[model samples]
Structures are given as C-alpha cells and as structure tokens.
Target: MNAEARNARWNVLGLLPAQLIMLATLIVPVGIIVLVSFSTRGPYGGFDYVFTTAPYRQILFNEGWTGELEFNPQYLIVVARTMILAAATTFICLLLSFPVAYFISLQKATAKMLLIYLVTLPFWVSMIVRVYSWIIILGNDGVIAKTLHALGLVDNMGSLLFTDTAMLIGLVYSYIPLMILPIFASIEKLDPALVEASHDLYGSRLTTLRRVILPLCRPGMMAGSILVFVPCLGAVLEPILLGGGKTMMMGNLIQLQFGAARNWPLGAAISIVLMAAVLVFLVWRGLRAIRRERAEAAA
Candidate 1:
C-alpha cells in the first residue's frame, strides 16, 4: 500500500478509541433520553414501554377530559425565562470579559501569566463551594448588607441573597472565566501592527476598538457566548441556591419532573427539547462563522 494510504489508515485507527468512547458516553445516553421522551408514564411514576405524544403535549397544551387542546403557557414561560436568563448572562459576560481580556493581552509576559492564572484561580475550588461563598457574602448579616446598613442605605440588614440579582451575580461570576479565556486567546493572537496602523490613520481608541478589535475578536466572542449561554440555560444550582428556589428555570423544571414530580417521560421530553434548542443555536452560530470566514477570504 502507498505511504499516504497507510498513514490515513493509521490516523483512523488512532481516532477509533475516541470515537467509540464518545458513542458510548454521549450518543448512547442522548439516544436513551430521546426514546424515553416518547414513552408513556407508568402507574408508579416510572416509564412504560408504550409510545405516546402526551409528554410533548403537556409542554404546549392542556388537554380537556373530552380531548380539547387548550394552549398552556406554564412550560412556555419557563422556557422563555430560561432563554432570557441565558442570553442576559451571555451578554453581560461578553461585556465584562472584553476589557479584562484586552488588559491581559497587553500585559508583559510574566504579568500576563499571573493575570491569566488569577482569572482561572476560581476553577481550583469546587463549584458548589464557590456558589456557597456567595451566600455568605450576600446574606442578611453579610458584608454587603452590613455595609448598606452602615451607609444608611437601608433601615436594616437587607439581604441580597435569594434574589434574581444574586442569581445573576453567581451566574456571571461562575461563567466569566469561560468567557475571558476564549477572548484572551483571540486577543493574544491579534496582530499588534493592525492596532498601530489604525492609530497612524488617526483613529480614536474607541473607533479602533469598534472597527478593528471587535471584528477580529468575533470568533472568540461567539465561542464565549455559546459556552456561557448553553450551560446557563441548564444551570440548576445557581438558580436554586441564589434564588432560594423561588425562580423556576428550565433546569429546575426538569429536575422537578424527575425528582419531586416523578414524571420520567416529561423530564425526558424536556431534556430532548432543551437539547434540540441548543443544537439549533450551535448550527446557526456555526453557519454564521463559516460565512464570516468566506467573506474574510474573499476580501
């Protein structure tokens, strides 16, 4: 056999193990969830073998005794709320990450490494522990509440915990590192000559950022957005802990179905829906990236 053909065969053989692992771990579990989504609920809260569309219908409508379909907004509201929370978190992270990334990118080598380490330092701790720390900081008798009271901003130690603001704070804190790393990577690779040229042309700093830096950083921003948004949509811990279970996100709803509600089929259906939505978003982003690359090449 030719050397090229032998090399190709070896490459495929090298990838075979990873392909099998992915199939076993990801594909199999997702396939099981999809199958369960179309199943019927048994008398005792488990799934039955019978196939049915009732779980999907439950997400969209209320069925009358006589089988009339009435539009229901309960699950719809949850989905919308999830989307809004995810989108807002992604946007906030994007805004916050850029400046930090830019600063890091401009730093000397030692300082840059130190700054990058600091940015990722939070990951060394367990996520649950990190979230719990916010509870102490935002609690009624915590630093924020005491400071507010001391400043006469409040009559008492008003807690920031268990509010939407608290939830958002946790989400942003948890995901900001994910956002920053990608942006920093992009900015690090950016040609300094481009910035120098823009300045030589007498472009203002803001103008340069808007016209040059942002365009070059688009891929990183998109990557960071996807990383933040998708996971935020399915986040249960932050909403539950910070929002005090008062807020109902899609993840919380799914957890409820599987745990308290004891409806496996419904939970599986919700999981499927969430996965499909994420898949659609990924496809859209991927297509946009491809188009942008094509445009850049043509230019």
Candidate 2:
C-alpha cells in the first residue's frame, strides 16, 4: 500500500480501542437508560418489563385516578431553575476568567507556567474536600463571618451558608478554572503584533479589547461557557451542601429518584431528558464550529 493509505489504516487501528471503550462505557449505559426510561416502575423499586410512557407524562402532566390529564409544572420548574443557575454560573465564570486568562497569557513563560499551576491547584485536592472546605469558609462562624463581626459589620455571625447565593458562589469558584484554561489557550496563540498595531493606531485598551481580543478569543469563550454550563446544569453536591438541601436542582432530583424515591423508571427518564439536552447543545456547537471553519476557509 501507498504511504498515505498505510498511515490511514494505522490511524484507524489506533482509534479502534478507544472506539470500543466508548461503545462499552458510554453508548451501552445510555442505551440501557433509554430503554429503562420507557419501562414501567415495579412495586417496590427498579423497573418492570412493561413498556409505558407514564414517566414522560408524569414529567409534563399530572394524571388523575380517572385518567384526566392536567398540565404539571413541578419538573419543568426544576429544569428551568437548573438552566438559570447554569447560565448564571457560566456568565459569572466568563466575567471572572477573562482578566485572569489575559493576565496569564501576557506573562513570561516561567510565570505563565506558575500561574497556570496555581489556577489548577484546586484540582489536586479531592472535589468533595474542596466543596466541604467551602462549607467551613462560608459557615456562620467561619472566617468571613468572624472578620465581619470583628469589624462590627454585623451584630451577629449572619448566615451565609444554605442559600442560593452560597450555591452560586461555590459553582463559580469550582468552575472558574474550566473557563480560564480555555481562554488562556486561545489568548496565548494570539499575535502580540496585532495589539501593538492597534495601540500604534491610538486605540484605547478598552477599545482594543472589545474589537480585537474578544473577537479573537470567541472560540475559547464559547468552549469555556459550554464546559462550565453543561456540568453546572447537572450539579448536585453544590446545591445539596451549600443550599442545605433546600435548593433542588435537576441532578439532585435525579439522585432523589434513584435513591430515596425508589423510582428507577422516572429517574431513567429524567436522565434521558438531561442527556438529550446535552446532546442538543453538543450538536449545536458542532454545527457552529463547522460553519465557522467554512467561513474561515472562504475568507
């Protein structure tokens, strides 16, 4: 065979193992969940062999004993809340990450490496431990409260934990690195001469950022937004720990269904729905990437 053909064959061979692993780990489990979503709930827990649409119906509507369907908003509200929180987290992460990423990108190689390491230092700790640390820091008697009380900012150690604000703070803190890394990747590749040219033309820093840097970093921003938003949509630990079990997100609801509620079918259905939403987002991103590539090629 020719050199190109032999290389192509080798590439396919190299990918075969990964393909099999993905099929086994991801595709198979998702297929099982999709199948279970259509099945009937058993007497105690788990699911029965009988196929039914009751789970989906229950998510969207309430059925009376007489079989009259009424619109239900409970699950929809949970989904909406999840989406809102995820979006908010993504926005906050974007705002916080941009400056940090730009600063890192502008640093010398050694300094950049150290800054990157610091940015990712939290990952060295266990996620659960990091989250628990937030609990201590944000607790009423924790550092913030103590500092505030010492300064006489408040009459008491006011509650900061177990609130939506606390949950948002945790989400932003946890996901900010995900946002920063991508933007830094993009900014590091940017041509410094372009910034010099803009400045030579007497462009202000804010103007250059708006017209030059942001446009160039759009891909990284989009990637970071998706990375932050998708997982935030399915966040469980932050809501449970920080919100004090009062905030119910989609992930928390799914956990409850599978654990406490003992409704495997419903849980599977919710999982399927969440997966579908993520798939939709992925497809949208893929299409946008393709179009952008085409536009760049055309230009």
Candidate 3:
C-alpha cells in the first residue's frame, strides 16, 4: 500500500482504544436509560423488565404517578412556559454574545486576552456558589437594594429575589461564557482583509456587518447557540437556587422523580424525553449546517 493509505489505516487503528472506552462509559449507560424509560418500574422503584408505554403516556397526559406529567391543561401550560423560557434565554444569549465577540475581535491582542479572561472569570468559582450568591446580591436586603437605600435612591427595600427575573439573571451569568467562546473562535478566524475590502467597495458599517460579517459567523452562532440552549433547557441549579425553588424545569422534575418519588422508570422516561428534544434540535442544526456547507461548495 502507498504511504498515505498506510498512514490512514494506522490513524484509524490508533483511535480504536479511546473510542472503545467512550462506548463503554457513555454509550452503554445511555442505552440503559433508553431501555428503562420504556420499561415498567418495580414496586420498590427500580426497572421492571415488563414493557409499557405508561411512562410516556404519563408525560404526555400528565397522568401516571401524581398525574402531573400527563397532558392535562395545567401541565401543558407549564411545559409551554418551560419551552418559552429556554427559547428566550437562548435568543438573548446569542444577541448579547455576538456584539461582545465582535468588539473583542477588533481589540489589540493584550486587551483581547484581558477581555476574554474577564468573560471567563466566573469559572474560577463553583457554579453553586455563583447561583447562591445572586440571592445575596438581589434579595430584599441584598446588595443592590441596600446600596440603593444607602444612596437614597429608593425610599423602601425592593425584593428582587425569588423571581423569574432573578432566575434569568443567574442563567445569563452562568452561560455567557459558553456563548462567548464559540463566537470569539468564529470571529478570530475571520479575515480582516475581507472587512477592509467591503469598506473599500463603499459598504456602510451596518451593511458590511449584516452582509459580510454575519454570514461568515453563521456557523459559530449556530454552534454557540447549541452550547447555550441545550444546557439552559435542562438548567436546574440557577432556577432552584435563585428563583427560590418556584421554577420547575425538566431537570428538576427528573431529579424529583428519582429522588423523592422513588420512581425510577418515570424519571428515566422524563429524562429520555428531554434528551430526545435536545437531540432533535441538534439534528436540525446539523442538517442545516450540512446544507449550508454544500451550498457554499456548489457556489
């Protein structure tokens, strides 16, 4: 065989061990979850081999267990609200991150590094700590309220804790880094010459940004959206801690079933449904990306 063919064979062979380890660790556990989601729960809250659609039906109709997960009107409203929150959070993160990334891309190397470091500084602390800290910062007697009161900006204390706004703040704070990184990566690779060329061709800044910059950054935006949205869909910590446990997300619901309710199969089913939703979104993005790449190639 030629050298290139031999090298390709060796590369494939080299990847086999790591791939096998991943399959054993992740793929196997996911397969088990899928199976359990479709099966019945035992009396004591374990998987029973008896196959049933009751779990899925419960989720749809909000019936099984306490009948909440079923598709009743109240449950439907909650589910819809959850989806809306996820969508809103994703859209907002993208809108904010894009401009920050654009600004950073234009900065000198030292300033850019400092800005990027600031964006990621939160990661130096634990996520739980960050979420919990918001309570102190936004509570009735929290930092903002106290500071305002001290400065005579307000006559009375204002309660900001345990609200949807607080929840959103936590979500945005936690995931901003996740949104920024991919966009920065996409922007960093952009050719400065192209922007200059667009300007020379008499394109206004707005026109150049909309037409030239955004199109090239589409892939990055898509990737960053996925990074932010998928985790936000299942966000458990920020909501529970900052939203004062009033917020009920799929992640929280799934955890409740397995922990307090002692219903493994139902919990597994909810988890599977959540995973499926995320998978569908990812698949849609992947297909769109593939189509874009193909169209670009053809053109």
User: Per-residue CA lDDT of candidate 3, range 58-158, in tens?
Assistant: 76575456645435554345556667877788788999999999899889999999999999999999999988889899988899999999999997865
Off by over 4 Å in 3: 62-76
Candidate 1 lDDT, tens digit per residue, 141-207? 8888888889999887567899998999999999999999999999988998999999999999999
State each model's CA lDDT, in order: 0.93, 0.92, 0.84
What is the Å distance of residue 248 in model 2 from its true position? 1.1
Pick by lDDT: 1 or 2, better one: 1
Query: Against the hidden true structure, what lDDT does model 1 obtain?
Result: 0.93
**Against the true structure, candidate 2 has what lDDT?**
0.92
The residue-level lDDT of candidate 1 at 112 comes to 98
Candidate 3 local distance difference test against the native: 0.84
By lDDT, the best candidate is 1
* Decoy 2 TM-score against native: 0.95
Q: Which structure is stronger by TM-score: 1 or 3?
A: 1
lDDT (10s digit) by residue, model 2, range 11-69: 99999999999999999999999889999998778898899999888789887668889
Predictions ranked by lDDT, top down? 1, 2, 3
